[model samples]
Target chain A: MDLVKVQLTNSEFLSTGIEKLDNLLEGGILKGFTTLILGSPGSSIEILSKQLAVKGKVLYVTTDETEQEVMDAITRFGWKPEHIEFTDIATKYSKSVLSREKKRVSIYEQRSKLKLKELIEIGSSGVMPAVKAQEDFLAIFSNSAKTTSPEKIILNSLDFFLSMYSQEEVLRTLHAAKVANIERAGVLFIIMTKGIHGEVFERKMEGMADCVLELNVIQKGSTFERFLAVKKMRNYAKKIGIARYAIDSDGFVLEMIERIM
Target chain B: MTNSESYVYNQNRIGLNENENAKSSCPCITGIDELDQKLGGGLPSGNTVLLVGSSGSGKTTLSMQFLTNGAKIGERGVFFTITEPLFKLTKNLEKFDFYDKKMIESGMVNLIDLRIISERLGLDAEKYTVEDASALLEILKDIADELDVKRLIIDSITALCYRLQTKEMIRDFIFKLGSSLASMNCTTILTSEVPPNEVKYSQYGIEEFIADGIIFLGDVDRKGDLIRTLQVIKMRGTNHSRTKSAMSISSKNGIELTPLLKSRV
Candidate 1:
């Protein structure tokens, strides 16, 4: 049986900025689709996401990396960082922790000198050391996503939020963002690590997304090879294939795509 | 007598034997003539006065008027704000003719935010510890020394004390701050917030005790209308009238105080 090619205009799709990937994705990611990218350590998922951001107005919600670090990585790869607006959760989280630690130290040093009444007051006031309210990063990300009408949205890694917040909270925010992106006809990319979250949760995440891609690094006697698997493409099963890829000086280079039967 | 007549009578009575008292005690004249007369001349120099009032009772306005008036007399004043943002405070001040932007720019009046100072000093605690309070006191002293400030106002000390959880910390902070600023000869006014109609002059119930003076600001219901009133409950180093006065705030007259006439209402 011969496969017939269907053409989609540029307006109907959001390009991943790689010609080969766009061809493999059938003109690129469909507009309004939420794409989930699952990768393990050494899989170069970061570079892939940054490459996806090269073409559009991007709101990059970075949880595991600071804005400066992300910009430095993007710059080092010769990508333009000017078009990206970052909601940097990593720096905020780190600063909150450091500030809490300093406050704890100061409280400890003054504890012995405080009178019993003073200690009682401190206890009653609920201003004890390290008791500051934690910031709701999910809400922050949701707010930024709602306020800005970006063409592309990228959340680099779900593990940070999953460890900090409940699954329900994370899912609610993700669903809201997905609906907003759908309304704006924009693309949303959520990055998560493979195998860390349970298979059930992983499947739930994949079910939420319109498309799912996975990057795997395999070792054969100390020589590791990287492969990008198009595991799920809702309503477009023909695009399900695997591509062996390398990160060369020019960025993500797709060596070959093996079509799935 | 009519209210206007009493206002004129009080205005005429100002500056009578007040200059002698002011010269002897080195008073920090508030420049509000009636309030200055009520304070014999003005607030005693280097004294920490607790200006206690509820919301919208003119505590902030009175403090700003005091500082701006001091600026007019060639005295530099600094307002360390903890509750309101500096921009919002200045925006509100812009409506008053006494609020001169030139005074702020020329270093005659300084408006500083305590939160910004804490951030700059790397003290990021939401609730300040005793050590943090001590460090804050030092910062205040350093600011006083650096600016050569003659008058200092900490708008709403309640907010600052809220961050300071313990009574001992608040006491130590205020006592030390008072002494340090007093040593520098900086007349300080620390605003304290309390519930309306509450007899207490401060939120913590301890600031009024430590403070050298207490100026209580309140509102009285006069025939279904609320009238702001100011009363000097305690003023050291000079004789002052303890009678409550009717106060009004306006753009033309920043703060006008008239003796509360018994027969007017």
Candidate 2:
């Protein structure tokens, strides 16, 4: 069966707070487009993602850092935090696969609550024994998969599953989750990663995204500097390559003196 | 002010509740019999206490005990510290099993990170005296308002008064601090350090005057054995025994105030 594809011809996106960069990327990056952000350890990708996240329901997937550390990083951004709520979905799950062993205890407890009579009645009725009840339990347990549309999503790093499995298995499931999160769900999927095949990964992400932004932090005698690149915007000639920028108490500031021919 | 020649008189009395909410549902047991008695049964509910002491003088221990007792009796507690980093605080308190482990999860006992505010300050420290005590007092008031705190202790008023040099200013800070705590209706304890050789009085006159009570803790050398002592110097609106009691500190039992100070000097 073919999944219905409802494509918006003139798709739009928000370069978050960067104005000229956004112009280069057509209005903004299209919603539901999965963009890849590559940066160093001190890169403010987390900051930018959090700034965009606070306004909507954001599901942050992180493997590189602790939940509290990430929260602390974003807190410095001075975002009004009334509407934003956080949850740590990293715990209580088998990162190797989508298996939850903790549910065994609760399942036993629910099974104990049931008597032999109820099981036999369903069995005699030719109804699938405990099928509905198992479904109910599964519904309660499977929370991470519940895609909340009309929200922004921040996937901090795919490096989390590194310890649990081979890169192939991780990349497969992760890319699938990212695609499902973007295509089936209406959200701005900002997936972040680092290392060797970064450009390859970015190119693959570009294939699946509407806009791509690369952040670089370099040292220039006595001080630190940052750069942003808008690699591709489907409908726009988005700003490409490194641009001069500034940073302060709030966040990154950029300037682009480009050819206006 | 000289002890005999000087007497503290309360003026304006600008801060203090009718305390209609006095002793409201504070089921906390301080584990110390004497201090509990002096507090009119474990620090009146909703009061804030400032605990002042140098680095290893049992400031955190005292506050932890207050919270431990609360956690035991199903009362809620929160500890907000700015002096030390968080990892150290957790590592230090790991020995006290009495601090209910479940409190952090259930939100019964929480720790607010004020390091963010403290870390961002510009250097070249300013004097912390009575004149400027209002700023710190406002911070305390904000904490109480935000968290619905019942009992609080600020470890060192000495830290607060370090910046301020004037005794009158220190006194004003103590007065406003105590008054604001009273207004919030929290049973508070503000700790301040007095040089061991110095007389036993809160640095500022306002400490005793504005407070419903005062407790003095010190180290007394009895035959080369440094014994800790605690005395309930004054407890207004209550009949508290004026006793310079013997006290001891144990890892398991934080501070034990023995009521055998009947032999007055």
Candidate 3:
């Protein structure tokens, strides 16, 4: 395994699997630091998170996609899903708010399908206070940390909480998450969509995140190009430019298209 | 308070004459004339009506319109809201022009939040235990009787089914609730979410059978886009139109129905 390793104070940095991407972040992302992935709908952050999951234990907290869908994607990417853990908040919200679509009714079935060590479902009982839901999510994460001590935790999106709660509530929850990340020395990936929240809300998150990775899609002629740019990384080797990437059957492949020079 | 005193209170609160209540045989006006026409004249009094639709299909709006219309005519209403909080419901209703501040102040429209009831019963506010459902029924009956409510609306009855954990429990609750509302001579509307691709009108497949009337709201696929439509699937006491009428809803006018859409050959 050509996994690059870097030493950060009080923690170990593991390779992000992509050599060019790892080189940009000075070998890899810090083990205990929180990384924010900012992008729009079409960005391939899901694939990127999956790529990162391959290195070690992953705890994927999904608020957008179903647990099965995430597992299917992992398998498609040539990784065994049994290696990862999932915390599904989206299915519960969908069951409470939306109609009982065929997919939502299958949440129980999906729960049965997961291995005992791989699933934690919050809000399964019913509609809950945003604070309570956040607490439940954090509680499971902490418990999993005790048992498995996941090396990486992925929060699929913050958009769901934005819909269910106030800016202050979500920010407070993120603050707690950041503290946990530091204490556990585990990397946390917070996925978010840009241009959805107000300027102040976005600025607050950008300031709190230890590292911010922005993904943008540019339309040129009849084609669209996707690029990942490292905007900020506190106390780490930071790259100032972008790396173009493409998705194939294997997974996300960083292309040698052009440097953001 | 005595029955006469309660009547005076409700009448003075709505600022309506006593003669309106004397015409008790007249159907409850839903505030939308097209809908009233489809229903042969709104919903039948002393009967329970079911409003079934998918989320975002305006079930809440339609129920609100019904209660507000009853309130306008000095008919007291009790709105038992389950999912949405009272403040959020009030705030959203404020966007509509027909929202009666005077009626609310005078207690012509009473909003009883049922969230606390679930909490008090030591049950999850989203899921329903049999005991909790029984408690809820008693609470509802007490409110309807105490308020002398002529109109009652339980927003999203499907939530109860979602929590109750069994088809028998849901059916039992519906039966008990329907009979209690009828005994009080209350014209009621219970809203529920339509299960996906289900042949039945409601998610549990028993609400339509138990209800006195069923107003099914849905989106119709036209050429490229979807249009809102309302159909009166069943009205037990009245002869209603079976046609699906084109419908539209806005904050200003609430729900408006056009002429029935002609079925193309």
Candidate 4:
């Protein structure tokens, strides 16, 4: 099926809150586009992405951090938890798959404990099969979009997802998210840490994204320099150089460090 | 008995008799018994031990062995990489039998790359910058708290010195790192690169002063064949064997150390 691309006006662009980055992004990130934020360890992508969540109605899908941790981060940024709804896959996966009690208790067995009507509505399950879990995980966002209709969706760090699921399965799910983004005229921000996966896997994921932003941290002397480079963006005029920034108590503040051309 | 079996038996002497001896320094083992015996009974818990050696002197392999072994008994570890990227370190570690992909996957072993942070801050020349050191300490604390890490390895404190090139900055960094590790009750191994023939235990001569113990790794010529050797220079709070011992790296065993030599002094 042909995906419907939303024509976004300048005002419709999703602001990243950091005016310097927003200016570089041509007002802000384009609506209905799937953007990938790639970084290595200590790149501060989480801080940058948290800043972006405040810009629009965000459905934050976390696979690395716990709900409390995400909430703490949001609060630290002076943003309210009410502003962003979360889909906590990491916690759910840990409790369902990693917990011994849950593993020992069969889903069918759990269903027998529940009433017939309850089983019919909620399904006879304690833990879902791997494939089914992936399906439901994707479905949560789709079903929520029908009701709440979030303007922006953030999948924090696709690295954990890749680790848990097969690349093909993850790619299939990402495709569904992409189609969903186009249909809703909303944006999807996929977080992926660079250097965690092989070149082939990274290249394949990059091919699926509408925009790719690479965040890097370089050591100069005793200080850490952070740079943001827009590697790929569809239709938008690309920025010439990287943006230098620092994370402090107030949030991400662009520094005066010289940009790498 | 075979040499390897005898080595195993010698190391297990402390472990097999743990119940009977009631050892005062119930140290956390590096998983290599021969090396552990050299440092009394493993490194005293909650101490910062520095492993100083030249590049390719098996500094990383030894430290990785320490963390991977701790990870085996469900003790979590965090490797803060300043010189190497997490990807390269993990990839390099995969060749060793002790390297467990599951440990990393399950968050039992966490590798945080700080090289970029140092690079971004322009931390190159010898400069006394407490701010940079504090910022780094905060990051380490955050990870340590989050992971509840027991075994911590900062592979190559040499890179930190290279960035904070001044003696003062390196000294301050080591002091702060040492105290913090102690406060957290975490057993840490801080590795550094030194000139191959340098008699000093560390690059700056201050790392030895700040650390709780020092392990020096180097190459020695044995009948024209170069052989790696490790020696416990000093370990506070315990009676340790202060003698040079044969050290070798193996894909199967990770880090192997000969039983400590008879004390000369």
Candidate 5:
């Protein structure tokens, strides 16, 4: 193996594995930071997220849905049992952990509103890392430069937190994401979103991320086609607005060709 | 007293990673050899393909071609036929000399039998709602993994889009599906019917307007003779054949292609 490592430049960031998208960012995205994929509903955000699952593990949190349709989507992306991971936080883990934590050490400064700390304490308290899952996640992240920091992480598709959880919970999750940035090492989050929450999430993720991209499917002429854009990339020269993406199907061979917007 | 509390989760979580070379575009599953050749090795595995044609214009047959080809090539293929019953799809395949009895038995070629599935899932009527799409998709996912389905042929997404109430809901649903399917590495083929007058613009643009590739099949009139034509409207990542080629539907083969211009016999 050549000892020379090729760091991607702003121009070379987009590798045409997709059908219509080109590299719209400065480089191969700011590695190890949070990135939001903001899109209207039915955009290819999940598709983009699934395609980007080569390095890190994806943790998808759905608040609005409990659909087999969504779960099956991950499997369709060619993730084996070893690769596909699922956690039902709202019912089993999320609500219980927080509720239990709140009941015992429930410190109500005013009970009218709470800080992000209270939110985090409740959500993460009593939530043990199902040992098997820990082992699996470690195995996923083991092959890397042995350092104090991790390589990458993902939130997968989370549009439900907007309606389901408190505003405090949402902020708490964002705070948690910042912690994940340090804990997970090289982490680039692909947060799938829809509508207004997408915008809100994007703003929060922007403060937390090193890069941000968008995937929009538009009706151009008489065909249903997709578009991709590199909205922001920190510490790199970049293009702005929407980039038209051509989605192809070579299975991990997505080609992001040009910036259209 | 209106009481509000804060929330937080300091869970150290790992998640799905971005692809190493994640720039590849996903194209539709083009089962036709010539079509694949002309359009650069079929459609990308993760993107959607739209097949638009008038009724009895080989739209279903083309979708079948996509599924059969995926099966013959050792990729798990799923054919979710919304317009026809399972038996009809099987019977129709027989006309094209395409059915592999072994594949059917071995579960390599999965015919979702959307018509029967509709009945089973209580989606029997033509006037189903968008809420039905999610449930139906769940069923599709079950078959996709159990059969290790890599190539998906959804006979139509147009019907679902049309039956839905609002554009926002449909958009959100499709975004979820299109992105999810792409992540699944699915070379999906979705067929949509076009009315004769609305040839320029499709009824629901989901299939034609949202897919990676667009192929139009229509019957053109040569004086009193009605000849069919196939045209590639758009293929984002790869080069597509611009010329409109003549096509025919036969009892034995289903869909047979012919050049538009005269080839002297």
Candidate 6:
């Protein structure tokens, strides 16, 4: 039997949707690398992340917002919502909580109607059986990533996961996701709030990421100024730069990048 | 014929009410004649039987045959598949003449995907905690009760137990599930996977101890041919032949058993 060998033609770089930013990095972000995006509140990182969805098929894992809410924001900036699939963790999380509460209420109502002997038997068991822990959102995210096999993967925030799960668990999942992205030659963009997870944890995340971008918002008098910084680019030291950016009517507009010599 | 009428006709053709064996108090007669004869009737009613086997050894074929046979005799059955999707399983089942799509459609034999059940119950964890196991058991019990399911099959309990971390949890889950189903007079067949050459009947080693019966299915190489075999390791409340029998699966007959011929090689 003759064997047919198939080859995957994946580009070496993926554009961040900004021509100036793409030019500074020679092409764009490297393929098969995890890009960590750090942003303070009101830094317009969400818009920047949404702009990346135009590159290819995107699996937008939204832990911070519902799928509808994210899509609304995307369309508000005239970005096409096509080719983007969402694993809505926020909606699923809320639904899970509501279901758990309902189960608790039902159990309580049943226990209230129980006879003395039955109640005593239950008391002997100490705790009610079949009360499972909260569903593992990390596993769900991982499953979505594997099944979807998107060219561009976006996790809208790590802070929600960190708050829900332990640091070790979150790190393990992040490493697994990173390895999966590398094997598939896909770009993964993970968004997180700056400074909330502490300096040590932040540094560890930066070490894991192949590229790190920080979106900083500064207060100047009563107005706010937004700047996008290419803090770390693996194997490209000369590409480290900072750029003033704003979320204009069209979308995220990069003014200029001052290359850090 | 309409689907309902077709199902009724098929059930009648299979001699539904004529099987005195099914009407017996103790045994739930599987429709396979030779195997039922070997068991002196069939599997014990309300007992949990571990159908342990290696891959492609006719375990699934035999289990489906059991459920379809039960459905023919007015005993409703449900198959909870953990590893395979329902569509894929049904597609595969379409090859067997004993398999009737009408049986599934009529709800006489229910096919459920455990993954769907887990999703519905919000069990997204990689490993099921003890509480998750208990919740799963409760859900299973609810399903059995709701369907009035007389026969239940969990195709490959190995997959289900993979999510259940500890041996203690496995044992507890199986024990409680067995007790609950047995109380409902639901005879269960939990398919278990083992390595081809392993002596153990189950992956976790605790299922065999908890189960009331064991049906071991395996394949042996004899004269350059791999022959599937089935042996009754144990069956509670019945005098069953412990001898191994050669088994063959075909689209025409589903699963057929014959005496194992001694091989000189």
What is the CAPRI rating of model 1's predicted complex?
A: incorrect
DockQ of each: 0.02, 0.01, 0.02, 0.01, 0.01, 0.02
Output the lDDT of residue A208, model 5. Answer: 63
Tens digits of lDDT, candidate 1, B1-265: 9999998886655555465565655788999988888887788899999999998888898999999999998999988887887778888999999999999878898888766666434464468867677767766787677679999999879999898999999899999999999988899999999999888899988999999999998888778888888899998766788999999999889889998755465
lDDT of 4 by residue, A149-248 (tens): 7888888868876776688888888898889888888888899989878889899888989888889999999998888887777776444346787888
CA lDDT of every candidate: 0.83, 0.53, 0.73, 0.73, 0.56, 0.82
Clash tally, candidates in order: 0, 33, 1, 23, 100, 0
Model 1, residue B176: C-alpha shift (Å): 0.5
Better of 2 and 3 by DockQ: 3
How accurate locally is residue B235 in candidate 6, as Cα lDDT from 0 to 100? 82
lDDT per residue as tens, model 5, A1-261: 111124243332322223223334433444345667676666756656655544334444433334254556656765442233333333443454354344332122312133322322222132322222212222222222233333434444455445445656666656666555645544545465645655565566666656667666778799867666676766653356555555444233334445433
- Candidate 4 local Cα displacement, residue B167, angstroms: 2.4
Q: How many clashes in candidate 4?
A: 23
lDDT of model 2, residue A36: 62
Each candidate's B-chain TM-score, in sequence, is 0.91, 0.71, 0.86, 0.85, 0.79, 0.89
- lDDT per residue for candidate 4 within B1-265, as digits (tens), equals 8999998886676555443324443577888978776765578878899998888989999988889888898889877776665667877999999898888778787776655433323332244266656656655665575568888988778767766757788888888877887777788899978888777787777888889888889877756766788988887776677778888789999899885444333
* Candidate 4 segments exceeding 4 Å error: A1-261, B1-25, B117-128, B259-265
RMSD of each: 14.8, 20.2, 16.7, 18.4, 30.2, 17.0
| Predicted candidate 6 versus true structure: per-residue lDDT over B28-61, tens digit per residue | 8889887876777688789999999888778788
lDDT of 4: 0.73
Candidate 1's error at B75, in angstroms?
Answer: 0.6
Q: Model 3, A169: alpha-carbon shift in Å? A: 22
- Each candidate's fnat, listed in order, reads 0.00, 0.00, 0.00, 0.00, 0.00, 0.00
DockQ, prediction 6: 0.02
